[model samples]
Target: MLILKIFVFVTSAIYACIAKNIILIVADDLDVVLDGMTPLSSTRKYIGEQGVTFKNAFAAVPICCPNRGSILTGRYQHNHKIFNNSLEGGCYSQTWRAGYEKNTFATILKNRMNYNTFYAGKYLNQISITISWHQY
Candidate 1:
């Protein structure tokens, strides 16, 4: 039993040490094809060069709030139910709070993967006091 416990502890510690860090940067109206990244040379040098870059990624929703919802929940606009940047469109609406907010990528990383997560910048157009750091 002591040997098993020691093995478990050692394995857990090793796994924790090897856990990769995650960084998600969402830039609005920035297009790679249009030389949008040229101004962020320092960011490109420090983060882009050292990290994996998705050169061919495209947003399925093409609009701010709906696209953000899709990014967070890893769902299509139809599945996430966010049609636009309005409360009526389900951007930070009660339905989104109740159904989709709890299961976002940030929440999953923080809860299931045991990662310390941080979020900054505008989330959604209709987002107000209902936002929490833990839920971002």
Candidate 2:
């Protein structure tokens, strides 16, 4: 299919250059030992075999919202200060509006490195309504 071809072309292009693409997939509420995990065999075969794996990697924040923010910004929760999930006091409208949207690693890659970034998944916790989604 055309989508598959496009995917291959884009991925190949990304890997071909010195400025490699950064693809981050964060799945929540999952706990499995990589050695024993079986459902994602295809992913394990492809990305696992051809890509890097971090057996000792960890999340800086246990909360979903904060963790996602940390990943985007490349900063610890303490530094980004997204202390809680989207909520009355600490959600997208309040925190992200403080300038994170423009300064994330996504933005850096897109704006500085001129990479094409794509995010296709769940958004952060409570700030969904106020976000002006950027390509980064």
Error of 1 at 11 (Å): 3.6
Q: Per-residue lDDT for 74-130 in model 1, tens only? A: 899999999988899988888999889889887787777777777777877765333
Summing lDDT over every window of 10 consecutive residues in candidate 1, give the lowest-scoring window.
127-136
**Alpha carbon lDDT of residue 89, candidate 1?**
90
Residue-level lDDT tens digits of model 2 in 1-105: 999999988986776576655667787764565544467788777877888667677888878888887887888877776778656535464557668867887
TM-score of each: 0.75, 0.65
Best by lDDT: 1
Q: What is the lDDT, from 0 to 100, of the residue 16 in candidate 1?
A: 90
Candidate with best TM-score: 1
Candidate 1 clashing pairs, residues 3+ apart or interchain: none
How does model 2 fare in lDDT? 0.68
Error of 2 at 6 (Å): 33
